[model samples]
Target: MSAAAARRGAEVVLGLCAFTHDSAAALLVDGHLVGFVEEERLNGVKHTNSYPANAIAWLLDQAGLAREDVTTVAYNFAGRHYLRPLLHVPAHLVDRLTQTRAIPRARSFVTVHHRYRARMAQVRSQFPKAYLQSVLHHRAHALYAFLSSGYDEAAVLVVDSLGEIQSTTTWHANPTLQLLHAINDPASLGYAYGAITEHLGWRRGDEEGTVMALAAIGDPARFRPLMSRAIRLTRDGFALDPALLPLRVLSSRYGRVTSAFTAATCPPRRPDAQVESVHADLAAALQERTEQVMLHLAYRARGTSGSGLLCLGGGVAMNCVAVGRILQEGYFDEVHMPPAPADSGTAIGAAAAVWSDTTGRAPGGLTQRSYLGPAYPGVILSTAPRPGLSARRLTEPARELARNLAEGQIIGLFTGPVEAGPRALGNRSILASPLTDDVVKRLNATVKFREPFRPFAPVVLADKAADYFALNQLSPYMSIAVPATTLSQTVLPAVVHANGRARVQTVTQEQHPFLAELLAAFAELTGHPVLINTSLNIKGKPIAGTPELALDCLTESGLDGLLLEGWWVTRC
Candidate 1:
């Protein structure tokens, strides 16, 4: 999409991954992730499921552009054709038909359903002057991984619940690329994982990551055997045991599970319910099994394609544990996973796929960085700067903020470009004194209104990470789960999960010097080189982006301080 726009004289290409999970939009004037986010921060629904009209409008308004300036509209789902099948058939029928020999035909039937016509009409009506094209689902997934991976050649594995034609596919690519293999029939590893997630009493699509975290604390013994029985591996790849596991029950429409499944496992937990050891263990089983299947497929693809690098997409790619495992195991010499692995990222992927198909040019190189979304350029409103607040150099401001935090203040830190994925990486984050567990308890109960057991993550200085964690790599994406030392664990207990693993983000000077210095200043004061970092928001809403939003949160929230540049405001 960025290339096409660039070719057509577009000075800036904005890629919006909006209106799906997390409701965020990205701006790429050329070909970059200038902005990306989920609407949940703004809308307050856990996974806000509506178009990010607000985010879209906000980005354009901030960029000082008008709607007419957008030359083309490259939608991720190529119209309603992508989702038509889910409407008519029963979940069981969809599952059964998917496994049949005529699966391709059924897919076409679904993709070309009445919604396709309606979507086309809607497109014409909505963007009459803009060019419109529909890219297949998995193709988009492949593009997201390949483009962002920064590799010249690699094997791309796109796995997710069903797309236009298939669930999981393997694409072998160099500067030139080819679709090597596809698995459309017999369900997918993505679907299998989702099924197990639902059976374990978590919400299917939105709660899968939570299950992955829950896995680390659980025992997968009994559940692992059952999951293996339910999802059996075939001579070709993997298959579901339809007798034991009915794929239909896993559909979004399934809503709540049947009494039989819940009765067998345990009563399902509400989305906001407390996490139990049993649920944790079930999550563990599911995650372990998922890693097992992925490793098997990676090995197979590596041998078949003789490709050194692997590009991963689809919803399953969101499993950071699996990605980290793939990297740690050296399954492929180099494995790349896009920041946005879910359906929203498919928009950028679809654009890449369409561009490659039309021009026959392989994706040049991976995206150098993930600042591909929209950003606020310090719009100093005419209304007034909040009392005793002024934009200053990030250096001293960051240090002062750190000093306050070391003295036991919960600081709301918003600076630089916002993050793309689930983790709040310094730009749009809240920093607190990790030395005190009170921050966690108070924030969850008073501000976040979520489960108390859920833990905050650590933003540690890259150089000082060894003092706190035993890991070696930079966790800028907060993907891995590693243990904190016994001493560090005792002091920063709130950020550590039940199993003692911290989703630690290592801050380097290049990434954000301000945050890095803040960590240093914090260490100087308290001898702890990390701060408790959490998404800057209350429960059920997207993180606030604008100053008005920030100020409103400060007034309404139970926060201790606010830090935007040098301007720091404290409450009580």
Candidate 2:
């Protein structure tokens, strides 16, 4: 507690970010996080690219308080009113007005800042008494990483598409945060990667994961020489050399893109069509170069902060493959990153900043679980069950469901509160047997209906986690990737990625009693405690929060059953 806190007692703070990719709301009582929910989770819309009205209402409702109870309200974006002049020009208008990355970046900033302030007006009207503070983009990202990392003195690095005017920021944060270095617009590593994604006929923000997955199949060395011309390392940091970049052509859909990045003048719309050796090599090179920049920045941060721990945030930090590379370097004693490393988690950072300001102290620690969304009442046991589907309310869902799982059933498990972030953490997930690759192919082909090459993550019983994967960290959110042993891979072939690693979500009985019960039952049945657990949604859709959405997935997809809350629902 600080001097101010000693006098004022406890306070409630609300943190918000809207008009962003992952719109979210976070609530904090004193210094502890009470709830954090993304708009996408509740709305059933992927990315939820607008104001989080539903998320905010839930945050206040969950805490049993009204908007007036919040002493402070924190917003994620800053410098909007000041930076609007820099941004008012149209996106490609700068290219027509003055052909440079800086001008287009100005255009981008204007659009972002104006929209943010307009939304805040509505928020302010709702909570007139709460003291509102707007947090800087990179500052929020840094503070969130530091507080969530459980490190006392940690080096924090944030790299994203664009944050206000800058794209990359390196900081040494503890009591007082100091900026080590920052890389400005147009020369963004994040934008460079996004441009490549566009060139390869993929969605800029959404399909970066596909590029990461394809990297494992390609030879990074094939494109290493070419990538060098585009980016080079400097004494202080790295540089994005525009001269070496391809000539960008403006598109209505894509702001500024280059046709020369690909072999075709107009490529097929399907990303799967661009999955050949050339594209693979490009992806490999991109991943390799990105890892190089990240490792260098991390090592530099180690020295700058003089701390043994490192925490990374921003959209770039979501690249688990690159993150795995950094984990291998052994440069820092420990590294930590939250599950929602991207913009959504910034809501939490905004709240943390308010707490730090009022209390004159840093709340630096870690949160272990992520089932933070609203929970449902008891699922009604329908007397008149739907045709072609059987229903039974079970006292022991784990034991009953384990038998079905052993017989190769795909069941939708809905229980407790909804998960807050991008990843689904058992509370809202579709489960399948991990014994064979056929189940994965079935999941991709019939259930997810997305990319064939995209991999499924697993939820392992926590005690059995070390036996399967290399590390024993409490990966409750499947954020980190670790190599799986050959023996375990052979047994659990469905969940392992092409790169020989698995993004594992480990759950203990203490944290997730329902999931632990199911895992234990599966172990008793088949002697294996792993399940192919993926978010319960079709491709291009958000995970289901409401029971109706979960039911819809069961009917639309090839799912065999629906274990919703307490009532067991299965196809006849």
Candidate 3:
């Protein structure tokens, strides 16, 4: 293993994460993953969880190696918590100048363990000292959900909204990733659904899944006794119960979500403010008490690892409606989340735990597509020259992109790679014309400008997804959530939702044969093989990673055609 490390080939590693938020970067070579990004999709900045120095220089220029041919960077999380608050100034001037709370909880646990362990040794001297390493915050989200779950043995939860001090952990991962439970920080079901998405005014850790998709438009028995007094369970996971906080707890009791997400409104609308009905019944009792504490933390990680196969991830398994009520309560026969199940796929589980501890093998596993990031390298079908744009070249490019989305238009597509988390499975994506609801209020106010109660995701055709969503399995990463049938709520009315549910994804031509031949040519010309698709980024950006930011989000969106990789354009 030497001739200069075998001419610097496999055994690379570089997982990373930034100061906090969603900052990210990942790359692995011998342990496999390759590349992953998200410093707000190359700095258009939507979730700059800070410090992904432009996703670690685009993951060392997409691994063409040269940061001294990598030495093991890992990083996941290490903003050390001696109850952080930038190591509180004399514990917030002894709690607002002697207003009690004993010397700010013993000088915030004695001067934050030597100034947050020298600020995690200056975050490992910002790496590049031959694999600097750090990796622990939910064990890099349980090694990116057990190395992206190809499950040889499962049951790996993670949960999120607080890591470097725990916020629910659980593992058994037969890739040898055992732990059983953790919980710490001021108890959390991701901050008790981010303190009910910051007491319904919104913006609590990226709008707690837009309050779990606006709690399917309200009525969880009117906040059922404040979501059963905000989390406390503990048979092996559950805790955000600061005496069931009803409100006025502004900032840090144990953790105050890294300074209130700058008002996180995702469809959290608010311009001239309105929304009520107890803010959709406290977003339907905080998405039904966060799926009754994630099905009692998935039946206590399937009864302390009896493993029916689980594989979740932190950031509360990106609540695809509590992963569609834990795949309709079939207490796991198979689950697997990964499409960057938050904390930016824990930088591919901190470089797959130093390439499975210096290579013993553990690379590829996640089947059903996940692009891995960055693509659209020209040559997509071809034609566009640009002058006043209108370059066609369709000897049936998915039948003229399904007749420009059945003539309602919208398009965008982009093509190949560029899907490293936060759903957009149709390579880059945008599409539209999922029948109507006025192309879902013109893709939510002129192309993802956001709100009209944020929603749009269909992308069907994994064998017509059980005739339009109602538990048709194999959800190629639109995470989960089902229901929507009864004829996909009147023919895919812009990817359903007001209780008739939707958030689906499917699509399989072994994951992406040109988005399954463009949803089989839009189900052979509009018999509706589903499209809406979403996530070509804009309303808070991330998805479009280039092709000139997918032609500047199709020139400030309202799209009407663009298809980069396949080289088409429109507009005149």
Number of the top-ranking candidate, with lDDT as the measure: 2
Q: Write the per-residue lDDT of candidate 1 for residues 250-276, one digit (tens) a residue.
A: 224333323444555677666656667
TM-score of structure candidate 3: 0.35
- The count of residue-pair clashes in candidate 2 stands at 1
> Per-prediction count of colliding residue pairs?
31, 1, 10
lDDT of 3: 0.71
Query: What TM-score, over all chains together, does every model reach?
Result: 0.82, 0.89, 0.35
Where is model 2 poorest over a 10-residue stretch in terms of lDDT?
246-255
lDDT of 2: 0.77
Candidate 1 residue-wise lDDT at 140: 71
Pitting candidate 1 against candidate 3, the one with the higher lDDT is 3
Pick by TM-score: which candidate is best? 2
The global Cα lDDT (0 to 1) of model 1 is: 0.65
